[model samples]
Target: MPSANGDSTRNHLAVNPVFTAEPAHIPRNTLPGDGLAPDVAYQVVHDELMLDGNARLNLATFVTTWMEPTAEKLMAECFDKNMIDKDEYPRTATLEHRCTRMLGDLWHAPPADDVTGCSTTGSSEACMLAGLALKRRWQHARRAAGLPADRPNLVMGINVQVCWEKFANYFDVEPRLVPMQGERFHLDAEQAAAHCDENTIGVVAVLGSTFDGSYEPVADICAALDRLEAERGWNVPVHVDGASGAMVAPFCDPGLVWDFRLPRVASINTSGHKYGLVYPGVGWVVWRDAAALPEDLVFRVNYLGGDMPTFALNFSRPGAQVVAQYYTFLRLGFEGFRRVQQTCRDVATSLAERIGELGPFRLLTKGDELPVFVFALRDDVTGYSVFDVSAHLRESGWLVPAYTFPAHRTDLAVLRVVVRNGMTHDLADLFLDDLRLAVERLSRQAKPLRGAESASFAHGASAHHA
Candidate 1:
């Protein structure tokens, strides 16, 4: 029977005969008088989900689309546990603790028991926490010296994720976003320094920029901040939003001096679900040391039995993702992780190279940095826009995104592809064939056929969640 929710796959035969009196139409906006049988309810939701695009073929997102069967099983087992209830689920909490320790070491923070970190819902929450830490630390220093901490500001590239914008808005901090100028797509040493003032709380340097998947110059930005302190006595800390790069750079680009190896970096964050090779909704943030994060922000609760010190924006989230992260860490040690990331980087660079050879495309980034790349149509070959190709690819179940650049480069429109863990050489080869065909077919059009769907494409703060 068809339902008001528009689910036509509802089998009238209920899992239990007693529940056969299930209503003809499933109530969507209103609470149901009686629930449907388990099988019937499951079928109704499952069938509708089939309309979604193939996850394995989704090139628009940096999130992981696949994991091993064993990891999946482990996640299923831990779904019942609450991450916030540290006392009840001691082992789960321990795993979370261990992951932070590992990340601190990975980022090369000084060996100290007080270096604090926590897992959040994802990188967005992690960023917010890091921002709060930066703001609080700055406030404390100013107050101690009897200077008014009223006008706090944060500096970052225009390409930073939306979470940072939210932090500025919600917390009443002024955002000094360095705009993208001609030939400069992200925050550079000179631009970053120029944006800072005595009121600046901290500077954010993205380890992996969502706009083009290139790393902003964290080292240069830090050095620039150091110069600001020495020259003007304005000491500003740096926070690396390594949501994608934190996991990739360590294993792939071993010598990158973007982490705690730089003295001015106070904090760093990463999405465990992205390049960390786990499923969705797990993130980590590590402070250089306990001093970087103000003490008053942490809360200790004994209501759940043992007194636990916690710092997170979320409460009572499923512990499955954290458990999965621990399993991944144990399963793939240093060398194992190195191989997986290295393979992904190789696949991305190879795909980007072949994509550039497909006639009309010009590469903005080559995927060597973050296993991601952006490309745009050449000026001479202008029959259709990149959005036209994005819409075309969606018809074939691929979700490659197309959006224009921000600020000064708003004139430039392009398509971006994120090559994640499961993207194999075979899939890349298949995508190239599809892209070749798409380009050849679109060349026949006399003018642009930009669809209304193209209006939805946006980059930076508006579309950072993707």
Candidate 2:
């Protein structure tokens, strides 16, 4: 009994098939050697997400990438979940309502009449909605004024995000760009006014330029538009694309009058994922009043028996992100948000100051201007290029974007760092330390690292000239 039982147990424990029954030719570990295993990629991604508590503050382009456990848990709950329960989540409408109210108050919407807004997947969709609304309103105004409908255009700075171009392309409207020069990085009031005529639908003044993080002097733009309106009798309105700066500006620069306080600004659109401190796939568009939102744009859908009013380009979005945004508003009240933004500003300023001492690098925009800081190689750094330094930084796992200035400033390449949530002082220090190391390494390199000329490889440019 012992012999048979032991033999069978030993046989079962063998790592390979029994030689007694099968031919022995292959090794047990023989398998294809793909470069990356799925499990390994998953682990690396998990590590990256958890780095700095995922509060690395690396995303200055937006508020921050959401990595809070609460956000993750909420997202998991919403995956593959339906959002059409009229009975259970009847108060679900309150989610959008609450966000609308918060943004309305922050943006300083008028005290009287009904203010209208909606949540979108991101600022891109919000911009699309804003453009569509402006177009519809322009058409109505044109019909009322008995003007020729042949031409309708939007005036904006060349530094505007690509979405503006897409908006014009999608609606068949002319995109009248106010080109940027060396001294002027935003849409000049003079240039913007020149583009406006009876055919102009709206002038989009960016509160925060995506390229430089500069505010486009909304007050000046509005005042200039007012003068044009009085002189030309043109009723063109202003739309503020505050995707990156909307939330942070209120707390950091409360005196800034880029919001609804400006008489000409008809609607304000922002990315909830950016400064709102929510995860991606959440954006908001707020019209001054119900009258601003076109009736034809809002579609009444009868789902789960009751009719629900929907206006977004894409329907059937997950409710989890919305719930998460509402949670952020509740969790981080006004004071909390201000404190967080202030922390980012302070850390970014510190990094800027530290980097200022480094040789051959010039600060393009002051860190205090916004959380984003842009830098370029100084003239004294003859042999070394910003592009070369960016390649060095990449070796150390930094994702700082470097690129050339748009249009007129294409000859100059710059680097930019976006300070987002989870970017603590310590993390900033680490980044600076790594940057120093990268700089030293690049200095010791034998050759210059020039970026590829093609747009496909443009990611390399974001590092040195972002």
Candidate 3:
């Protein structure tokens, strides 16, 4: 028997009707007694997420915010596949290998049938893996020569991403960070040479500094290490943290020699999710040669029904991101990637030009290298600070981050904007308008901004431009 309001053929039954009407009140902290309808649960979560900052308008992060519809479809389809299980999902492994080869070739790896590398959860894991390889290789050489393999140390600038610090802490390597000063915000060859010793594992040269969108002098650092090796008999390799620039320099500035083109660059790591034009959570680490990555680091496991050599920090991650990366590589070949990166560089340059014209700000980096830039308030402009302008921009849904420099350069506070793939000239123009308005609003504030003094520590305190 069906009611007059109900369809005669449909069964009108409810397992838990209590939550069906008032889904908004669903307790988020604890598990419910009974599950609600799928749509109801989805709506509750989705509605709450609507309040989050819009991804497209976020200028502080270097992560990709958009992708093609086809890439989205492909990622959705392979979301359930686990990347670690090479036996069950062999094709995913194949795709990963192909991607590695492509990256190796792109980075100018010597002509070889296979390259040693792996996909990571992000640039952080990729960096960790690269650090491990460098450490192991150094240890192997030390042990062969009957030298002390203990007290391994890594060298980099204070401008390095925090992941490098994490790598040092987690892996028992000493972090010798070079302090940044005035105009020199990156690790120079002299600074790196000063940090080297017999116990030094490797020198980390940042291809794209997260500080001010500048590319560290990789070749110069390598040459400095070469001289150090000749003088002190301590041979140290170079690992390029190409998180953002690896993808850009290859296309935008082909003349840049920050990659394997330099002989001493043993390994390189890049975020596939950043400038690689893919969504979040994908990174790569490619060694110049198979010998650069020690055999002991790769774990050979047959638990997945095949002999698979795994060399990653995490296991059982989503293979969909890797697939999306492959899709991006295939869809956007060399020419396509070049055009996209060139356009982003152009937009960033244009924005930098326009923002520099604002008169209150002094351009730190001109966004000519990696589609990113940083600027500081002129000393003459005393009424308002970058923090105030940052706060005002938030009202317009723009997430421009303002923070002080690290270590020796902490006195200089600046604002940074990371222009990604989807950011266009029109969006840049709109952002400029909003930025101008924010500056205007900040100028009119009667008192100092709420928590203005502490605001410098809020956003990019630990994180640099990238």
Q: What TM-score does each of the candidates earn? A: 0.94, 0.84, 0.92
Clashing pairs in 1: none
Q: Write the per-residue lDDT of candidate 3 for residues 300-325, one digit (tens) a residue.
A: 97745757677988988999999999
Candidate 2 has what TM-score? 0.84
Instruction: Give, for candidate 3, the lowest lDDT window spanning 10 residues.
Output: 7-16
Looking at model 1, residue 168 earns an lDDT score of: 97
- Candidate 3 backbone overlaps, count: 1
Stretches of candidate 2 off by over 4 Å are 1-63, 83-88, 112-114, 302-307, 445-447, 452-466
Q: Compared with the true structure, what per-residue lDDT tens digits does model 2 show for residues 299-384?
A: 88664577766788876777777788888898889999999888878887888878888886888776675677778888767566
The residue-by-residue lDDT of candidate 1 on 1-466, one tens digit each, is 5677665454333333334554566655566668767877877667667998898999988888999999999999999999998888888988998999999999999889655899999999999999999999889989999999999999998888888999999999998988889878889999989989888999999998888889998999989888889999999999999999999899888888999999899999999999998999999999999888888999997734666778988888999999999999999998999998889889999999998988899999999999999999999977898988988888777888888777878888889999888899999998988888888889999988994346454544554322
Candidate 1 to truth, TM: 0.94
Error of 3 at 28 (Å): 2.5
* Cand. 1 Cα-lDDT: 0.88
Q: What is the alpha-carbon RMSD of candidate 3 to the true structure?
A: 7.2
